[model samples]
Target: MKKQLLRRIGLLFFLFAFANAKGQSLYEIVFEASDITYKAFLVYFNEQDAYMRIGYTYKGKYNVVDVKYQSVTGQEDGYNYLVMVGSNPRFITNQEKGQSYNPDHFIWVWNDQNPNQLPYVTDDPNFDASHLIQCKSYIEIDPKTMTDSYLRQFFRTDEPEYQALRKMRDASAGAINYNTSDNNSNSGSSSNNNNNNTGSGKSKMHLLLVINTDIGDIGQSCAVDQKAMEVEFREIAKAVGMPFEKYIINGEKFTRDNVERTIKSMQVGNNDVVIFYYSGHGFRWSNQTDKYPQLDMRYSEYTPLTEKTSLPLSAAAKAITDKGGRLNIILSDCCNSDIGRNQMTSTTFMASRSFQGAEIQKLKKLFIDSRGSIMITGSSPGEYSWCNINGGFFTLSFIQALKEEIGYMRTGAPSWEHIAENAVRSTQYKAKNCNGCKPQNPVSAVRVSQR
Candidate 1:
């Protein structure tokens, strides 16, 4: 059944790319309003730009290709939608051909109330002709959080997830032009001076994943968030063929002491790549000075919120930096608001994918090739970091941007600075576009160099 489904994924058809997900992301979505199950491939050029190859089947045999390749961030709700503004639905059967209109837009919604619910399109069916039958623009589609396994299923053959990553990059840069094998070979064969990495030289990198998923208020959401990070961080290592040592602190062992002990005692290669990711409640202390938020290390709702329960992001960065790893990255996806909102230092850091491929060269541009100390957060010091059941908006956006940097979304030198910029912009859009949500401008500090 899966292979048959894969066979039907005709080229040049529109796709959701699993909801502005990672670069070269592909997803098959079913809307509550239509019988047609849509397959989509979304590749982010940047947060403000994306290409969609919208496709659906006619009578379960023919593929409908309506490619509307444009940026579809939810202007109405930040990062919760893909507004394909057109009235034409392809009711035809053809092989790898163009449509009268681009039908590349697909809708995905986050089931905020029921976290376990698979994404069922929530767009109302009673809209005008301009909108697809039941496809509305408010459903949240988190393309950035998809696991590599589901991604692998999209190709009919047993293509490696990384290989698909390349095809998607190429398909994205050359929308409707998925057959760029010759060009890819040429590019792969060519020398790339920018990717001459100076890191620890293919040794085991280090990834530290810390999550407060068992904490009271947002525990459920945090669990999913933690899982996504695990998948993503591992995929990063796989994409670049980097051997890695992973350290995780969560559940009953989640405490400030554990994180501190782990970091202070952990041994990383002097030139290794180390990344620290944190997900949970975060805030600023009344007397704090840094722009990043502190980790809410408490593992249970009954735990007291005090100095013992928290770890500042800066301290973590400095600790990681002190280890002398060649390339270091720390990301905190909690709020930066004052501690308890009554200006207790207030509350919210408020905020907000993956792959492999020959575009593997592109991956080198950001991962294997760069050097520096980098840190980013989901929101500014005073705003609330927003999230639903899917994950933190900031984390999802970071994945999206990472995919963009490695995908064939652009040409020339791949850049860490560009990836950081896209992360901030994408998270900002998700916050700014929401109805009750306040605007969130993420904060990032980077001191990295790429040749």
Candidate 2:
């Protein structure tokens, strides 16, 4: 995605059962580039707290390396990548058991579903782009369910291997930086997260999940997004000490008519929060002057992109904002790319991670204290919003960023600006060298209200 390219992570090893811990998210990605191939396993906790086991064949036989790495999910370029960099790799080779430490400037920059992605690793921190290797056929597999005989050789999470990884994870647990997985589960306990909002009245939150679960292209991504948003907003509700009501607009009910009716007819109050989130296809028309993308609400694949079939994000935000809710959040996770071209969707790798416990005060500051409207689209105009088998990059980043902003371990004050900035970077990070699409930079417009 940039001048410093991937030399195939010098060839990376991975582990399979890095899958425990409800507070963590797990994955195994297999990709090939240049003369090297990688079957890498990741157990992600937060942005910085993650582990990797890389097995690769450099010149001859297969070699396995244990990487206790810190990762940054999004970068600044048009390319998006999960950048894992570490030092002092512990090797488990064919010639020996776990060997002595070898210091190397090891790095793996990859995005699933084939972007302009490559895994880089080298002893020289300033390695040139000439050595960079491009990866292809990137796929996420469940080792327990996979049938590949070759990958089975590298799938070891036995006692010794597990212990080594445990040491790696424990070493970084105290690091103050909060860069973890987007699939974080330890947000907070539901019981403790509930309390009085302002000691005046009970607040109600409306979570509108309008998705295109039936669309073939982005349906899977949307479905996964649907689930992730549900869990996240519920955490938000609990954080703000409010009761939330959920409304689903998907499948046959995903028509524009249905979506419009739902938003226009909702009963919202002054203390309420309306989160109108749409996940699926999005586009921009030729004459459209608005920077925000239009949501394609057609129910069938054969349906035409008409005025009746499309809805602008501004309209949705205005509609929800008109209801007099305390805070109105409009999130659109889809493409703002080529005219009428559907966003490229990849196959499923696994569901999407997070911090364990959430800080109630942080949550109150963002959700309860903040007022007015927040509009976030996954991409800016003329850019492609990226999604893989994992999930939509911007959506994942929003949740990841949100978790960090409110996590007890996070430093500094929590602000929506940080979340918006991170979401844009994260989306760009995942889109780097992506096969089908260009760089995606998320756009956010916030109007703070004094109530």
lDDT agreement with native, every candidate: 0.58, 0.63
How many angstroms is residue 108 displaced in model 2 relative to the true structure, after the best TM-score fit?
8.0
Error of 1 at 420 (Å): 0.8
lDDT, candidate 2, 110-201, per-residue tens: 44445434455443344444644444433433322433343344545554534433432443354322233345432211223254556335
TM-score per candidate, chains pooled: 0.63, 0.63
After superposing candidate 2 on the true structure, give the runs of residues whose Cα lies further than 4 Å from its correct spot. Answer: 1-7, 11-83, 86-195, 345-354, 433-436, 449-451
By lDDT, the best candidate is: 2
lDDT of 2: 0.63
Give residue 293's error in model 2 in angstroms.
1.3
RMSD versus native structure for model 2 = 12.3
Could you tell me the lDDT of residue 148 within candidate 1? 58
- Give the C-alpha miss distance for residue 405 in model 2, angstroms: 0.8
